[model samples]
Target: MEIDIKKHLTFPVFLICFLLIISLIFIFPALKMIVLGAILAYLIKPIAFKIQSKLKYSSVSIIIAMITVIIPLIVLVGYISYELYSVVSTIITSGSILDINQFISQCINYLHINVNPNELSQSVTSSFETIISYVMNYSVSIVSKFANLSLDLFILVCSVFYFVRDGDKCLKFIKSFIPDDSINFFDKTIEDIKNVLRSIFYGHFLTAIIIGIFGCIGYSILGYPFGAFLGVLTGILQLIPIFGPWPIYWTLFFIDVISGNYPRAVVVLLFGFFLSGVDMYIRPALSSHYADIHPLILLVGFLAGPLVYGIVGFIAGPLILGITYTVLDSYRKEYLMGDE
Candidate 1:
């Protein structure tokens, strides 16, 4: 006798299978853009709300928020990119690096390495040529990358708008599928995730800006022509975790000391070392009273995120890790501790 297939496929089972299929169809392909949209939504949410208070229109508020935030951000990025291009171009074009090469030779000799200066110079020249060629190729590919990035940005914007506007509905839809008793656990896990992401992203960004301000002052005082640019660059570097401000400031210090500017070198030394050390204190200072966010998650997210997930991996990586951590911790509390 032929069994009834429709009878076996109950409503709940069919719904589950349908949802699973839907996720498979849409989730992975759009995951990166979705993650980016979440970040933008979180960041601009306050602005969106504040504007909505006056306008009372969610769509208009989102539009205003995007303009307010994204416009300035684009301008700032453009400025920083131009400054970086100028600096790199100047360094590559300038032929007055005899002193720098000599300093390298001295350092090599200090290590007691049996290396020829001419060969070292030639190796350096070859490396520079390779870098130049790579840069040229990268420049050629940038247009296509920009187009792709732009499309991603548009999707992100639309996603952010929906997330901010219909977030409650979305959450309700998710929770509707959860068992009533487990809803509390699900919400707790989500709360933990938000706290972690917010703490890491906001704290790191604020810390970087603070360091950038200090760096700008120090660079300006040092009579550096690109003080503002370097200051901004230092801030961007602060997002890198451990080796943030030291490399730039120390290099500046070295150049000064080598040029007989001992006092200037000492000042840069003090500033760089101090600014570099601030990350340790700043991270904890910015974490929420209830949330003790560690730097390791953000660092790992930053370093390994891009490697695994491409550019969007930066946000997705940490988010995935953070959520995993929360889930495991909750499981331990609920299931493992139940034995006790």
Candidate 2:
């Protein structure tokens, strides 16, 4: 007897079952790492493409791109991590924020300001002390868990290499699923995604570099010993929402003051002021704020992402929000705007 399998297994049924299986098998455990890999892949693929044209081997091209892109970043991150840990450890061991407190006292005393710099209640200091304890505890945990994190990072790197080399395959596979009527809509959505990624990777990162460059030049001119690393640290910290370059420079300013380097302290304060203004102008020029996703949205994402998703959340949270906002916005304009 001949069987008509098409009647028993429709396209939608097959698609649903296939997608469910795919999601169940891999999506849950590795989804976070994959997302990070996708971001790196998006940024590095163009360079890989350029190399691929000349090298005639995807593998060789991918290695060139990976080394070019990932190594320098690793170096920079390692420097920042080392410096921050060193500084924080020094402060905790020798343990005096008094230079800063003294400077603040002088400012309030001379400027006749209402700001009470010395008003940090014993209670407040103890609260901060408690927070520092938690951080120390977490650092120990981070050391213990390094193996797991390394494995995840390795998986992420492998994902990035394949993505840079064969990311087009993923795009093609996705495109295959789009219905004919939805082609135009799908293309527009893809453009929206491109725009959002541009804002995050190019706009945000370039702005950070600009701030970093300024820090480097300013600190070098003022004769700080670790100026380049300080600037880099400033730039990396710029990635966070509320924390800016002020904390680094201001601390340095206080250190200079305590060391009786009045000239350099003044210079540090000046650079701090100048770079603050530079950020206002330069960031807007670098990246487009897609769909005007509110700063509040970003602030929430920056704060909450880490709480929920560990370190990766800090980058992912704001980006995912922007993309989601654009998608919903487009749908509203197309389907809901007119109806209401």
Candidate 3:
């Protein structure tokens, strides 16, 4: 029996797609949180399974796993927030103009610059105050949206729990929709996606952690105030492709030069170079074992993701691009070049 060309399938397919679009529209607001939850769940699954082996209750195991994983993250964020607030508050209220003037005077003596120290100091102080004030106001606005943030968090938690527990089922459900002939392609694509995930997670994130730890140690040893914060900033910069740790180190070096601590400045600059060199070796060594994703793909993802999805884009953007690349590559290999 020949199936009707447009009688049975077209309307149903159209209706399904229409409904899907509607569903997506409804969920769009919380989409990023949900996506983040799924990504986090992927990371948490192995831990949850190990816990489940002992507890024998999936829900209990997942909750325990989440707590262990999430608590440290929450603490870190809280610490960063507190430190930022304290720093900003101090800089704003401490009448930094005198300090700026002194620094500018030192610059004049050291570099033989003929510029007006007072005027430059006033300009710099004004710019810092304006930026700090804007940041404080933004923070206040975020706090004002606490209720919406709480709802999003609630949804994220639920998503992670469900994804961790029922992830296999979800995979199976998705697999069932694939045609038999395309199953191999689907499977290969999925494996490649996994490799991409491992590449990004281990290669980028772990590298950041190692760099951050070294930064904390090196900066503290170098006697920089807020060494821990600088280290954290260094680690975060390590995640960006071109930025790396140079900004922090260069700023420190300049500060030292202005303050007539040339030796310490040189030492910090060298230490910064070491951190950058270590990244060159460490990132490739960790990521290459899983997948050798192109730097451009990741770079674009990192740069453009935040614009589209806010902060979560940092995670999702690279991932989506990497997965898309893998899928296309898989298709080419499995179908286009299969005979050859």
Tens-place lDDT per residue, model 2, 110-219, is 65788657574344567878998998999899899999889888889899998887788888899898998777777778878778778776666788888898898888
Residues 121-166 of candidate 1 have per-residue lDDT tens digits of 7788789789989988987887758977787777888888888787
TM-score for candidate 3, residues paired by index: 0.93
Best by TM-score: 3
Each prediction's total of clashing residue pairs, residues at least 3 apart in sequence or on different chains, is 0, 0, 0
After superposition on all CA atoms, what RMSD does each candidate show versus the true structure? 3.5, 5.2, 2.2
TM-score of each: 0.87, 0.79, 0.93
User: Alpha-carbon error at 34 in model 1, in Å?
Assistant: 1.0
Error of 2 at 146 (Å): 3.4
Query: Looking at model 1, which ten-residue stretch has the lowest summed lDDT?
Result: 287-296
> Which residue pairs collide, candidate 2?
none
Q: Which candidate number would show the highest lDDT if scored against the true structure?
A: 3
lDDT of 3: 0.90
Candidate 1 structure lDDT = 0.79
